[model samples]
Target: MNIFEFIRDPSQIGPWFHQLLLSAGMQEWVANLIGDVIGVLLIVGAVLTSAIFLIWLERKIAARLQDRVGPNRAGPYGLLQTLADIVKLLTKEDVTPDGADRVSFNLAPALMVMQIIMVAAIIPISAGLIGANLSVGLLYFIAMSGIASIGALMAGWASNNKYALLGGFRVVAQLLSYEIPLAFSLLAAVIWTGTMATNNLAMQQGELLFGFIPGWNILVMPFAALIFFIATLAEGERAPFDLLEAESEIVAGPNIEYSGLKFAWFYLQFFVNSLLLACIFTTVFLGGWQGPFVDQFPLLGIVYFFVKSLLVLLALMWVRATYPRLRIDQMMTFCWKVLVPVTLVVVLIVAIGARITPDRSINAVIISGANIVALLVTLGIIGRSLRRDVQRRKAALPGRSTAQV
Candidate 1:
């Protein structure tokens, strides 16, 4: 391929590189092995490098929300602040508590980072651009993402500290509870799309509904998108669903006993996982790499994909800046009572809608209309519940009259 061809279609670069390796007198198997290693390294490097920028971006965003200057000294617009922090962390002494389980304590951070990386392998960046376009990519993601909680639990339990152990318990309660709603939300999309392959999901979304509207899952199943977004906040341990690491309660949670590079790994995992979840949301709901002129200029798909993912990431950060962390009881209650039931109803709606027609546009319209009704009904129910709870509280108060209540 020529420079312009590769420029217009970056997917060709991978195959071209492999071919180049073969032309360099390498055996087929050796070339394949080398290609695989390069792919893995590139993915890992991209994720880790992106975390640096994400960290700074989040700090700047949070700072602006709080009306303060953020990270302006280290580099232009404080771009190097995360790098400076990395240096400081590297120079700090690595510490493990005396009573901590040596193996588990050390393994936890690596495990957490590794699980996130594994999930990244399946994320479709653009058309023909993914580490592994597995047939069951969505299922693979759901499975691998769950492993991070195990790492958290291991860290908490092995820390040999009471507070850390409590954090571990919270991790179990929070992650496990949210995973159900998360999975169900994704299930709604799967039912509607009839595919679990990430690339196929994106490809299917490329078509415009009614010749104008983007055939994104978010439009067809808004409730699923909302539920998925909320569930991911909890899944990623972002506020207000950040009950696992509520510093006031658990004293830095599972990673309390970790310091230096070990702690940095946990920290890196958080930012990177948040970005990955946003990428997943973009792919599954926002029409990954689907945009105007994408067919004519395939490289534009990469641009479109990241732009959508960035918006999702900004939304996630906005929520973190706006909401206070929820209490453990409240967090669990919201997941089980609200998110879970709503997601189940969404799945049911999609399932019924899909059975109504073989035409995708018709199915989308049916599902979208049903989603509107479900959302309104859900909001009304929630409002009524809140009002009743307020009235009961007023009725119990000695100073409150029935009229006032």
Candidate 2:
């Protein structure tokens, strides 16, 4: 059967197989348990498979972006490079520092990875494929996203190395600084829907404006979306915000003392977190699974969901490939001076808009207009401030652009 049919009648496939197992003399409980196992295996398989593809894809994109060949020798188009690396890591020596805290050092990678894997529990792959349908799905996600930093700290402090300790401390400062704006941005959606349910948020965004445009959250709360996306860059610790792992400065950051498979987990976690953020961005702003014909052909929702998510992922890879890393102070200043204020204003707008119109569509339209005005106003203020700063700096300079003696 085609996807649409499978989606339209999901029970048909499951129940038919179940009955066949019963007819073949399997116990009902055994059959049910086997089915559940298969479902879980599929989910795990999908995550691992996607993670592998993303690793290869990121490298290929990085290579193309820089006009260089990357990983061509490992496999065709370098597709098998990640697997080869995994095998290599698996076989490498796991050297733990003598002074390291044995327990925390060992547990750190698993702690970091557990939170990322838990993220998949709430994400719906298709119309009816969520692992869990919690009412506080958004809250759950936000909470899960934050815990990974603790693992970094654990790794850093446990390493008993000064560099590792510094990296861990930086992780706290950076994550804490950016998470405020990120939380506020997400709160805009929560305020708009009056619920933290991921599925509900997606449904809310599925409406069309003027019968053509998809009423995604980005349209209604554009600033929130922008702030959230930028914060994802920080959260993922990608370029321009990757202070925690500045190789030249800190020498591989918190995972400095980790080696072999332990180091591999830390390395692979980067792509996994990227995928998670991309998925979250797709869900919150881009209208997860909400596209033309997806409503009728529900199976296509899964396809649309993935396509939008991958596009977000590609944008991230592009940023990672091109943008230069920011100074730690500059990064902190941007978060505090720019993103926090902007997202606060966006969240306030969302709240006021909700108060003005209990009507979802009307409130959305009003908020959309307000967002443009807010964005313009914000940019103008920041521009003038920056211009003044430049003038001040020029006045303080010992020489002009020619740098005369």
Each candidate: RMSD? 1.8, 2.8
RMSD (Cα, Å) of candidate 1? 1.8
Q: What digit string (tens of lDDT, one per residue) describes model 2 on residues 264-293?
A: 888767888899889889888988878878
Query: What TM-scores do the predictions have?
Result: 0.97, 0.91
Q: Rate the local accuracy (lDDT) of all candidates.
A: 0.90, 0.85
With candidate 2 superimposed using the best TM-score fit, by how many Å does residue 190's alpha carbon deviate from the native? 1.6
Off by over 4 Å in 2: 1-4, 7-40, 402-405
Weakest 10 consecutive residues, lDDT, candidate 1?
396-405
Error of 1 at 37 (Å): 0.6
lDDT of 1 by residue, 1-405 (tens): 799998898888889998999999999999999999999999999988888999999999989987899889998999999999999999999888988999999999999999889999988887989999998988898898678889999999999999998998888788888889888989998987889999999999988888899999999998889999998898888999887788888778888999999999999999999999999999999999999998888899999999999999999999998999888888887788888888889899999998898887888999999999999999999899989988888868969776665
Distance (Å) between predicted and true CA of 194, model 2? Answer: 2.9
Global CA lDDT computed for model 1: 0.90
